[model samples]
Target: MTVENTAEATEVGETTEVTDTTEVPAPVEDAQIERALEAILMVADEPMSVVTLATAVGAPVKRVRAALAAIVADFDGEGGGVRRGFELREVGGGWRIYVREEFDHVVADYVLQQNPTKLSQAALETLAVIAYKQPISRGAIASIRAVNVDSVVRTLLGRGLITELFTDSETGAINYGTTDLLLSQLGINSIDELPKISPLLADGADGFEGDVR
Candidate 1:
């Protein structure tokens, strides 16, 4: 009975003893961060900002920025070895992800799939007239072309080579103009870079009129 009493007392003391165990969260992996960044880039229509990406990944802005930089650098490097891919860039006061120039064809092929033929001479001429005389109406393009350009304009719009800029003040007819993509395709920074026609025409040669004829 004395031994039992002593054991009971020891058991009571042990039951009163408290032990603390705390669990620490697992650390986030860099590979996980990189994957999250890539997923954001893939789905984003435009470039994603560092702040937005950080919020998405539940990470700090500095960390996200560092991650983006590393990812971009890696993609750009030969080690990445991905064809036709690039990184984020700042434009219009925001970041956007874009592919490298070389990959445009491949990307277009995958997404668009349909082969829309290049602009026809009539479409190009009509486009040129509108571009040089923007805020001009469809009537003006028709007059310059001496032919109906409704179909041509529609084709250009469908191809994303041109867009409606505004409506004519007098007639309320839609005014058309070239898009930045068109300018890029033409390899010119701006419309003003277009070749001067007076010199080209004055050299005993008719302008695009010759091309048309």
Candidate 2:
């Protein structure tokens, strides 16, 4: 009787195991992931990688990739929706939102006309850094100046003084260079015509703490 009862208990334990529920994290909905991605990209100054997005939204990389595709398509109006004035673009193995090229003229005209005031002191300094270091990234400019250059960079770009040359595939940094408008305004034929900095500084390296050029 004891052996029979033990066997019966073992069978009941197996049955209970089958009925028990083990909780696992539910899969994050794709729509939720898409919204999260958009929210992050909206204010991002730099393009974000898929791994970064996944970590941010607590979703798998695969889901983030799928959501990115949806966002790209939606912005392009591939799903029969109205095309957005801006678009999600992938550059340097990451993604960011950019103003659509088709409407560049309109934005440029508004920016140029709405603010005809001279460049601020901050803008001038930032511009000087870019002038000396052509194809420099915003972070590098900020690091050298020891201040934020987001608005200043925007102003330079809006004024057509600087332009994006290329993005670093490894670091995902966008390098900027002088534009023709800037050269024209400066009465120079090329970037090489810009004057030297050592003569202007107190000590070629004093004020900047080092040779910026």
Candidate 3:
């Protein structure tokens, strides 16, 4: 006689795993997000997207967008606050900090009257990027440098090292190039006279023809 298998029959040593996969959102603080955004924007060279800011600060996009709005309002002197010289502005499909229109001359004067001291290491690095990649936008230079190059670029321009080559009609961004003054100082006739990049570093690339001992 064989035992009949029924619906209640269970196999020995068989087990079932029931997992709770419900995703719980992390805690969000609007004020904290605003502060984080401020810090990031301070160093950012280009306008930042809400999604990008959200990912950087590990917050929701909705919260980041709201935080950006609040920042704009705060800088605009809304809710009985003092107006700021710099404002958070939306442009070129992203958000960035910009000086108020009325404060433009003040910033310009400050940049022009800066002491003629030696270029800072930051300026040197930014200049190198511009040299290697001529006709590059300020945003691109900043992207390569991984920091805001606004002040440095202005300094370079003031020092006659770099000049605005052209403006993008679509984005309105000014692309920069090393000027004749830069070439004169470097003793190079043309930008192509700059040394090839692969020769400078040591034993990094197999294709590099440098004599690396």
lDDT of every model, 2 decimals: 0.65, 0.82, 0.76
Per-residue lDDT of candidate 1, residues 19-84 (tens digit): 445564443466699777887777664345677777777788888778877676677774756633
**TM-scores for every candidate against the unseen true structure:** 0.42, 0.69, 0.49
Candidate 3, residues 1-213: lDDT per residue as tens digits? Answer: 233333433368675554444454554465588888999998776677788888888888888888998999999999999999999987656777877768655654565457557789999988888887777898888776789988999788767688667656688687889877678778989988887765565554432222222
What residue runs in model 2 are displaced by over 4 Å at the alpha carbon?
Answer: 1-29, 146-151, 158-160, 184-199, 202-213
Identify the superior model by TM-score, candidate 1 or candidate 3: 3
The segments of candidate 1 whose C-alpha lies over 4 angstroms from its true place after superposition are: 1-113, 202-213
lDDT of 1: 0.65
State in Å the error of residue 151, model 1.
Answer: 0.3
Clashes of 2: 0
The order of the candidates by lDDT, greatest first, is: 2, 3, 1
The local lDDT score (0 to 100) that residue 22 gets in candidate 3 is 45
- Candidate 2's TM-score: 0.69
What's the distance in Å from true for residue 73, model 2?
Answer: 1.5
- Candidate 2 residue-wise lDDT at 96: 91
